[model samples]
Target: MSGSSARFSGSTHLLCCLGAVSSTIVIAMPAGALARQAASPPTLNDPSFDAALPPLDSAAPQPAAPPVPVAPRAPAPDPELIQPLEPIGSADTTPPAPTAEQAGTGDATLRIRYETTVTGLAGFKTDAIEGDLGRQFRALSALIKDGNKAANAAQVKARADEDVQLAQRIMKAAGYYDGIASSTIDLVPGQPGVVRVTLSATPGPRYVLNTITVTGAPPEPTKIARDSLGLKAGQPVDAALIEGSEANVSLQLPQFGYPFAKLGDRDIALDDTVHNADYVLPIDAGAKSRFRNIQTTGDPVFTVSHLNVFPRYKPGDVYDSRLVEDIRQALVATSLFSTVSVEPVKTGVINPDGTEAVDLLVRQTKGPWHSLAATAGYSTGQGATATGSYTWRNLFSPEGALILTAVAGTQEQGGSVTFRRSDAGQRDRTFQTVLAIDNNRYAAYKADTADLSVSLSRTSTPIWQKRWTWSLGAEIVGTNEAGAALTLGGAQPRITYLVGAIPLLLGYDRSDSLLNPTKGFRITAKLSPETSLKGGKVSPYARTLLLATGYYPISPSLVLAARGQVGSIFGTSVDDLAPSRRLYSGGGGSVRGYGYQQLGPKDANNNPIGGRDQTEFAIEARYRFGNYGIVPFIDGGRVGESSTPGLSGMRYGAGIGGRFYTNFGPLRVDVATPIARKPGESVIALYIGIGQAF
Candidate 1:
């Protein structure tokens, strides 16, 4: 046979089989990608697929058209048309033909961008609900969410009926039982593969609740249970809200002495004609219980008398689980115990009064029950330092503790010993006294100080989510500075100051976390009055300070942190006040990007002189990746020599920092540059520590 005749015969054979096509050949896809693509009919040929086929000659003798049957409507190109036909077999050493990513020359095979926009859902704002209906509807389901290729038009059309049913089910779930939905898939005329699936819906009238019935009660006054429940007869019927009534009963019972109460069977019936639902819940509240005697189990750190002072409920009082939880939280806040639990004995035992006894189980932290830590740190501004601390807990029989801490650093060195006493009568009041001696070197001057103080702190949480604290204290301090700059009106080369004072402070904290907070805010204010203990340079004066910090999470991994501080000392000159008592700024804890005390006012000889008034503001945008974070920050501050505050002497600092978060706290490192530095000041600084700078 001639070569031309052979080619014609082969072509005719292919058309004969195509003409007789009736059954479909299912091409198995990789089991991994289960969602098939939905592609519209091929009104236009894809030029890319034409290159993969064998060349057909236009000059070849024609095969007559009568032998090949044809359909009335245009047929969509087979999805398999564009796929590489090379067989995938175990014998091939070369990697299965490069996936789109491996090739990098193109994208995953046959990808098309399509979105199933639902027009009928007006009031439904939830993305999850919208996605659910999209996945259930067949026309949209074949449109893969991954933006990959689409399935053939035949497959999409076959599921049209299922899509209608899916829309009906969606409406019923949303309390529109009488709603009707009609949908159609129409191709965009000029586009080759894109199709729009439009769903027109008439949401029937919403159904309201016909009745909310409770089967058995008596755990409370019955009125309390009804009031707390979210479902009401006149409200629209929401399956989620109706089901929540059972949970409400369970919660309300615990507040009324039935700690072990539970809600039983629930029946919810929907009526189509009236468009209303009947929701019924059965509650089983066990015997009424009262508080009996309390007992403690397991080894405890505090004395029996000290522990006894904590139970707020009396033997005859009604049982309140909330009180139990509050007491548990109170004990946990002490930071002395590793574990704490308060619960009913759970034994079947009942007293003559039919009351149930409770137990407090506490596991004290492992002994030696004391802490001894050695610390070392450094900064470009402060050079290097070494420090140590010895803490004895449960001192004086677990009602108090003694802590002695000594720190010797490049610019500052001090030692302090404190005795702290906790609420002796469980009144939430704590008392502390400190005797300290320190020799400090600053950018201003070097001084030696002897100090003594006693303070009282009372704390309360009016709203369980937040804390409030009030404190009052008294202090006496003596200080001597050598070669310090003269005060605005005082002595020139040397100064000695002695003062006795009273201090008051109020604080509020609602931050969600202590070491790393992403929400909430904290604010604290303090006022202290001082008088000359041994009149030399010191004068009677009042000092006030205010601080505020805020944290907000813009995203799960990003946080916005900010802080502001203002302080003033009235009735005293800058030189008369001890350096430790005067307000100062700069360093890692104050404004970054400046040396310690660099942002504040300077003395005549270019030394950092303490200021009577100070103000500072800082902001940081921190983005975290797992345990690490990058923070870019800006800090601005001013220091004035007088009691009145002004913008003069203002300095600006800016930098980027890093955080390595650990189980204990974040490890902080900051690299900064001064934005308003003078010729004599350092241009750059580095600081390292544990926890956020604030």
Candidate 2:
């Protein structure tokens, strides 16, 4: 075969396959004829046949239909357009790094924003339920909690789906059992990549209570238990309220002498047609009981004998839960227990009055019963002091504590050992004995003193503040003190003195809090009568002090507080009294801007000589925001040479303070300056401590 003929045959075979023609006709011919035939390619009606073959001999090629315009092949989509998802089941469980889309590439539209709405509710419920739904739904919080990072479309849809279920639950809690919630996630119109999530809820009519009933409760406490529940017919059938009220049924019975009361599950019958429900609560209220024998259990620090004194109820006395709760609080105040419970347990014995007798059960779990604490404070005149204490709360058991305390400072150094019994023979009462020795160096005088004291007191704690409190005590003190001579330039000899005193105190507190009262008032009066033997000359004197403080809340976050104090000495001349016993003011606890004992009478050498009378007044405006507070305060005080406390030489201090509130109390920093500058006084005095200054 000729070369031209072979080319023609091969070309025809390739074109046929390329065009996918169903039929082909092949004829052998002379080389010249074949060439001529090939030059004029076979023409068919099929568009593919003509296009697949290159024109033979450009000159002789039939005019091809105007070249069908072909669009330029689109470039392979940039691999960076949509980030490829990371393969699953990888050994590395760490999430793949976010793409530019996820990171929101400087485009606000890329990050998903969501909104929540509650419909078909009025008054406060609309705003309240809307807020609740926002918090309940993950779709609403995820972007915020995650710093508004963009989520993939799939993830966004998944969160919206979950939010629908949460919204419905929220509505049910608000008494709308037939509420429906739906969520939609869609790209914002005309804004590509900007996804919007909407969580919508339509609350049907709220169900109301048709009848509220309680069963299995005895006559005496049945009324009380029902009253305590605070639920009534015609009230909205709120799930949260129902659950809370059910708990009150069991709680109220025990308080009313039904010590063995047990509440069972509640039953509710709903009528969808009327949108109301019938509710029933069953309780097991045991026999009416009176107080009888005392029982102690668990890891109790107190014996049955010692424990019996804590409860106010006596044998044959009707049982009361308030007394039981008081006993529990008293035990907790001892700081000796990790857990404590005081309950009445059935004794199974019937009294002559036909009432069952129940034993008082005290259960306790010991916690860390020993502690070591240290505190330090500083002021312009008082300098700085560091105090440390070691306390063994259960040293003698039964709420007895032994404390060893030491104070070391620039002006004073002392140590003391104390034994205290809490709930001593009576609730909220204490018996304490102290032995102390100190060497003090102040501008007024220098003394080396030893003291022994015994006191019986009813004191208040931060946890259990009492309305009335009192204390009576006796103390004997021996000291050798050196003071300025009677005459200028005379010998200053140290005097040795023995002092005995009977101290009494009475206090009434209407304040709501012990350390941080916002409303109410408190007043305390202290009196001490003493006899001092100095150089074999006996001098009898009486010392008295009165203190009062009040707090008023102007707003939820602002409090107005004021304090006043007065002190006096009688029955002895100031010259004959012990220097340390003399009335004096000025310190962090008195006049804030002055040094310790700086405001009293001064000697010829310009040193404070102390005085027989003192008076002080302070006022503060405390404003708090969240856990922080700011206080502006003013203080004024004076010391007198006579028994009468007056305004003569009244010194005033003013300052602002800052507070950081904590669970325990407010931590405060005060910066005070004397209103009228005095020679040898600091411009600014700083005081740092816990709780309020008052």
Give the winner by TM-score: 2
Residues 124-243, model 2: lDDT tens digits: 142233444444444344433444334456766666566565566666666666777666666668776566676666777777788888888777777887898889898886766776
Top model by lDDT, which number?
A: 2
Over 399-424, each residue of candidate 1 has an lDDT whose tens digit, in order, gives 58889999889878999999988775
Instruction: After superposing candidate 2 on the true structure, give the runs of residues whose Cα lies further than 4 Å from its correct spot.
Output: 1-152, 189-192, 352-354, 485-492
What pairs collide in candidate 1?
Answer: 37-150, 37-151, 38-150, 38-151, 39-151
Among all windows of ten consecutive residues in candidate 1, which has the lowest summed lDDT?
6-15
Cα RMSD to native, each candidate? Answer: 18.7, 16.8
lDDT of 2 at 20: 21
State each model's CA lDDT, in order: 0.70, 0.79
